[model samples]
Target: MKVVVDTNKCQDHGQCVFAAPDVFRLDEAGRLAYVSGPDESLRADVEDAADVCPLQAITLED
Candidate 1:
């Protein structure tokens, strides 16, 4: 799976971090960071993260 986030739309919120720590995280600067390509096993978690993003900045691709 491929994960994409629109930084412009993101608000440095950490919901994605809680939903999928393996693929999403908050940097030391408290900014959002994530893996673009994660293992397929993490699809569900990534999807959940995408769903929780308030700004809908997260996108998934097969």
Candidate 2:
């Protein structure tokens, strides 16, 4: 699976980080950062992250 985040819409809320720490995180500057392509086994967690993102900035693609 592939992860995509719209930087324009993101506000560094870090909800995705709480939902999927292995795939999303806050950089030293408190900005959003993530793995663009994560293992398939992490699909569920990624989905949850997308769901929890307050800004709806997370997208997933095959």
Candidate 3:
């Protein structure tokens, strides 16, 4: 699965990180960093991350 987060829409609130730590995280500068192509086993967590993203920035593409 492929994941994409719209940086323009994201506020760096870290909701995605809490939902899917394996795929999303904060960088040294406190910016959002993520795995664009995470393992398929992480799809569910990614989906949950997308759901919890208040800014609606997370997108999942198969």
Query: In candidate 3, which residue ranges exceed 4 Å CA deviation?
Result: none
lDDT per residue for candidate 3 within 1-62, as digits (tens), equals 98999999999999999999999999998899999999999999999999999999999999
Question: Tens-digit lDDT track for model 1 on 8-47?
Answer: 9999899999999999989899998788999999999999
Tens-digit per-residue lDDT, 1-62, candidate 2 = 99999999999999999999999999999998899999999999999999999999999999
Would you give me the overall lDDT of model 3?
A: 0.96
Q: Estimate each model's TM-score.
A: 0.96, 0.96, 0.95
Question: Candidate 2: where is the Cα deviation over 4 Å?
Answer: none
Overall lDDT per candidate, in order of appearance = 0.93, 0.94, 0.96
- Which candidate number has the best lDDT? 3
Clash count for each candidate, listed in order shown = 0, 0, 0
Q: Which has the better lDDT: candidate 2, or candidate 3?
A: 3
Candidate 1 — worst ten consecutive residues by lDDT sum? 25-34
Task: Report the Cα lDDT for residue 13, model 2.
Answer: 98
- In terms of lDDT, model 1 sits at 0.93
RMSD vs true structure, all candidates = 0.6, 0.6, 0.6
State candidate 3's TM-score.
Answer: 0.95
Using lDDT as the yardstick, the better of models 1 and 3 is: 3
